[model samples]
Target: MVKIARWNHDGGTQSGFVDNGNCYALPAGQGVQSLLDAGLDETLDLARKVTGSATPVPLADVHLLAPLVPATIRDFVAFEEHVEGVRKSIDGVAGVVPEWYEAPTFYFTNPHTVTGTGEVIGIPAGCEDLDFETEVAAVVGRVPGSDGRNLTADEAHRHIFGYTVLNDWSARDLQRREMKVSLGPCKGKDFANTLGPWIVTADEFEALHDAEGFLPISMSVEVNGEAIGQDLLSNMGWPFAELVAYASQDSVVRPGDVLGSGTCGSGCLAELWGRNGSKTPPPLKTGDVIRMTVEGIGTIENSVGERREAVTRVPARSRPRNRVAPVVTAGT
Candidate 1:
C-alpha cells in the first residue's frame, strides 16, 4: 500500500504503513524501497497483505523528507496551463513550442539539495522575487539499461518506487538572470526543493492513476491560512510514459531518480499572484506559514524565515505586491 517512514514518541524511526495516530513498525523495517525492489506481482501481492498498523502523524509532528533523495530530479514542462501562464507574463513565451507540444520537455536538477516538511525555508539574499511551484513527483526504483536497453512503459511501471508532493521553490529573478546567459538554472533551483511527508506506492491508489501513470491528483497552496493556488493533476499535458520515453532517449533512467510534473498552471505566484489589473504579487514574509497539499499524497507545512535576519525584511510575492520578478526560465 502507501509505505512511509516516520519517527515515534520515543524518538525512534520506523518504516510502516500510513493509517489513522502512531507509526507502527513494519516487521522488516522496509519502506517504499522494499516494494520498489519487488517485482510487479510481488508488489501487488504485498499491497493486498499489509493492513496499516500506523496512525497519521499530526502534520506538524512528522518531518517529511524527499521520497527518495534521488540522484537527479528532472522537472518536465508538459502542462499547458504553465505554458500559457508563462506566455501571459512574458511576451515571447506565450505559446507552446511545436516540439514541446509533441513531446515532453525536461531538465535535470541538483539531487543533493532538499528541504524537509515543516522546516523553515530561507529566502536567498538578493533574491527579492522568490516563488513556489506545486507539483507531483515520481520516485524511480529501477535504473534503465539494466539489460542493455532503456525501460519501456511496462518496465517503468514496475520501477516506480512511489509518489510524493514537491514544492520547487523558485527565485524568479535568479532564474531569469541565469537563463539569459544560456547556461542553466544553477543557483536559482539548486538552492532548495521541498519534498515529501510520505511515499505512497503505486498499488495503494491503482484507481487513482490512468493507464499512462498520470494520476488525477488535486493540489493547493495556502499562505498564512489563506488559499493561494489550487488545481487537479488531470491538467497535465503529457503522461509519464511520454516523459519516460523522452528521458530515456539514448540514455538510461536510474533508480532514485525523480520525475516531476512542473508547476500545475495556477500553482504558483506568477499565475495567481494578482487581482483586478495590478501586477503586485505578494512576497512571502517571515512568520508566514505555507501549507501545500495534495489529495491522498499528504500536506507539507513550512514556515518562512530569514535565517539570521529579522522577519520584517523577508520578501513575499502575493497579491497586491506583485513586484515579483518576471517568469522567464525554462524547464527545471
Candidate 2:
C-alpha cells in the first residue's frame, strides 16, 4: 500500500506517494484532495500508473505539508480511559457520564488552522496551559455520485480514504473558562490542529481489523524526546466506522472531511494532570517538541512556537437586568 503526501520541493508544492524512503511525484497540480475527489479506486490506479514514470526523490529532501486541508473536522471523545482520567482531573470524579455510552460525541474544530509535521504551532495569546492531544483522523473519500448522509457503519467504512496522525492542540486555560459557560471549547481549541507525515490508505489496515472492527494498532506520544504515554487504537469506545456513521447522521460527510478519534487513553497532558492530581510533568512551554506515532500509519512532530499578543479583544457583555413582568388582570 502507498502512503500519499503533499510537500514542498523545488520552490513549489507537489503531491506524491512515498515508498521505501523515496517519494514519487504524481502529475503536477493533481493533489491528494483532487485524487480523493476522483474516487479512491481511480486514485490508486493513477498512482500505480505514474510510479514507474515518476522520478524518485529522497523523502528527506522534501518539506512536508498537511496531506490535505479537510472539508471539515469533527473530533470525537471515543476513549473511555481518556474520558475517565480527564473527568477525575477536572471534576475530581472517576466515572464517565452515562450519556456518553448512548452515542459518540464530537465537536467541530477550526479546519483553517491545520498545520503539518515540522511546523511551529504558536500558543494562542492568553493561553498559559498549552497542551497537545494525540489522535488518529480518518479522511473521507468520494463515491462519485454519492453525497453520504445517514450512512450505516458498513457504508461509512467504504467512504473512508485513509488515516493519519492528528495533534489537536489545546489552550487549557482558555478552554476551562469558555467551557464553564457551556458553549465552547472554541477559542480554546481553534488555534492549531496538526495532521500528517502522510495518509495511509484504509486498505493497508484491512488485515489488522479485530472482531469488534477496531484496528488494534499501537499509538504513542512523546514530549521533548521523552516518551509520555501509549495506547492501542482498539481501546476506543467506538471504532472509526461508527464515528463516521454518527457524523453522517442527518448531516453530510463529503470527501476530505476528517473525523478524529479524539485523544487516545493517556493521549494528552490534561488527562495525565487530572490523573496525577497535579501538573507534575508540567504544561508545554514555548519550544517544547511533541512527537506522536501510530504503528501502521506514521509519526508527526511539531514544536510549540512563542505565544503572540492578541491584536484585538471583545469587551465583556453587560449583565441583563432582572426585570419582572407586570401581570394583566383579565385584559385590564
Candidate 3:
C-alpha cells in the first residue's frame, strides 16, 4: 500500500507518496494541498510519476506533519460498546437512546488545533486529568453532488480521499465539567488533536473493508510504553462511509474536511475505568509519550508538553437593578 505524507524536507514541508520505504516529495514548499487542488485524476497521475522519478528520501530523514491541514473536522460517536462503557461512568445514565439508532451523533472540533504525529502537545490551562482517544479518520475529497445535493452513502463513499489515525486528546476533568453544562468540550478538547503517521490513500485500503465498508484494522494505544488496550476496528457499529454520508446531509462537506470514526471500544482510559470498575489510571503527565496505532494506518506518537500557566479568574459583578437586557431592546 502506498502512503502519502507531508514532511519537513528540502528546507520546508513537502508532500509526497511513500513507496518502497522512501518518500517521493512533490516539490519545495508544496504539500497535499497542492495535490487536492490539482483534483483527483491529476493527483493520482502525479503521485505515480513522482514515485518513480523523484529522488527517494528514506523515511528516517523526513519529519512528517499532519498529512494535511483539514478544512474542517467532524468527530462522531459510532461505537456502541464505547457508548455503553462511558454511560456506566456517569452517575446513573444507562443504555443508548432511541435517537442513536436513527442517526449518527457528532460534534465539530477546532480544526486548527491539529497536531501531527510525533509532535509535542501541551495540556490545557487548569486541566489536571489528561487522556487520549483512539480513532480512525477519513480525509474528504470533492464529492460529485456535495454542493447542490445531499449525497447518498454510495456517493459519499467515493469522496473519501484517504484514512488516517486520530488521537482525540482530552482533558477529562475539563471535558466532564463542560459537557455537564451541555454546551462545551470547547476548552477541554480544543487544545490539540493528533493525526498522522500518514494518510493511506482510499485505493490502498478500501479493499480490506467488509461488505458494509468497515475496515478490519486493529486499533491500539500505548501510554509511556505500556499497552493499555487494543481492539479490531470491525467492532465499530457504524462504518466510516456512513459517517461521511451523514455529515454531508443538509450541509456541505468540502474537500480536506476530516470525519472521524469516534473512539473504538475500550479505546481510552475513561472507558477502561468504567468497564473494569477499577481505579482510573493517573492522568497524563508532562513528558508522557502516547502512541496510538491502527494496523495499516500507522502510529501517532505524541508527548504531553508542559502545562501553561493558569490565567487568573476574574470575579463577577452583580447586574444593575435598572440595567436592560439585550433581549428587551430587541423586542422593541
Candidate 4:
C-alpha cells in the first residue's frame, strides 16, 4: 500500500510514506505539495520509488501534520441517513430535501483551517455545543482538463488521487445560527477540519469496490474510548466520483482539493443526540478525544482543547454600515 503523509522533521514539515512501522521522506526535493503538483503519473512513479532500501525513521519520532493543505475543500452531504438524523436532532425540521435526491449538494469550507491527526483543536470561540463529524474524503488531483467543460463520472474518477479520513469539526450552536440565515455553513465549520493519519492511494482500495464502484469500507468512531458510531462507506447515496464530477461542473478541481463524504449515518454526536433527543452523549468539549477509523485509510484522533480568548469585533456604530436605501422620491 502507498500511504502518503507529512511529518515533522528537522524543525520543519516534510512529506513521505510509512512502511512496516517506519517513515521515509519522498524522493529528495519533493514534498506533499510537490507530489500533488506533479499530478497523477509522476506522483505515482515517485511513490513507487519509496522502497525498503531507504533509511527509515521510527514513525514514533515524528508528529504528523495534515497530509497536505487542501487547495479547496468541498464537503458534501451524500448520506441520507445523516441528513435524517441531523434534521431530527434540530427542532421542527423535516427530512432530506427533494433537491438532495436530484444531485449531490456541497459547500466549500475554509481550507486554511485544515489540520492533521494528533493535533489539538480548540473549540471555536462563542461555540458551546461543539461536535465532530466522521467521514471520508477523496483527494482531487490535477488531471488534464480544459476549463468550462464538466468531467463525467468516469473521467472525474480518474482525477482522484487517494483517500483520507475526515473529521469536519463543527460548532453546533454557530452552525445552527448561520445555516438559518438561508446561507451555508461558515464560521461554525471554519475553525478546523482534521484530515489524516495518512493518505491511502486510490489503487490501494480498488479491490474494496462494490457493484456501483462504491468503496464498502467499514467505518467506526469512538470518543474518549467509548464506541459511538459504525457504518459502511457504501451507505453513501452518491459516490465520490459522482460528487467530484458534479463539483467540477464548469469549475476547476485543483490538485490537493478535498471532496468529503459528509458524516455517515449516526457518525456525529449531533445526529445521534438529535435522533435520540437527550439520550445521546453530551456535545464534545475541552479535553474530549475523538477517534475515527476507516477500514483501509487509517484512523485520525484529535483532542479538543480549551477555547481561545475571544477577539473583540468592531462595535456597531464604528463599523461600516450597510448600503443606504434609495432616497424616498415622488413617482416622477
Residue 193 miss distance in model 2 (angstroms) = 0.5
Tell me model 3's lDDT, rounded to 2 decimals.
Answer: 0.81
Q: Look at candidate 2 and tell me the lDDT of residue 212.
A: 73
Residue lDDT tens for model 1, 116-160: 687788887667667788888877665333531366676666566
On TM-score, the leading prediction is 2
> What TM-score does prediction 3 earn?
0.91
Give the poorly placed runs of model 1, Cα more than 4 Å off. 6-13, 26-35, 39-62, 87-93, 143-149, 210-213, 273-279, 307-332
lDDT for every model? 0.68, 0.90, 0.81, 0.85
Q: How many backbone clashes does every candidate have?
A: 18, 1, 0, 1
Which portions of model 4 show Cα errors greater than 4 Å?
A: 144-149, 311-332
Q: List the residue pairs that clash in candidate 3.
A: none
Specify the highest-lDDT model's number: 2
Q: How many pairs of residues in model 3 come into backbone collision?
A: 0
| Residue-level lDDT for 298 in candidate 4 | 92
On residues 47-148, what C-alpha lDDT tens digit does candidate 2 reach at each position? Answer: 788776789999999999999999899999999999998787666788899999999999999999999999999988888899999999999999766789
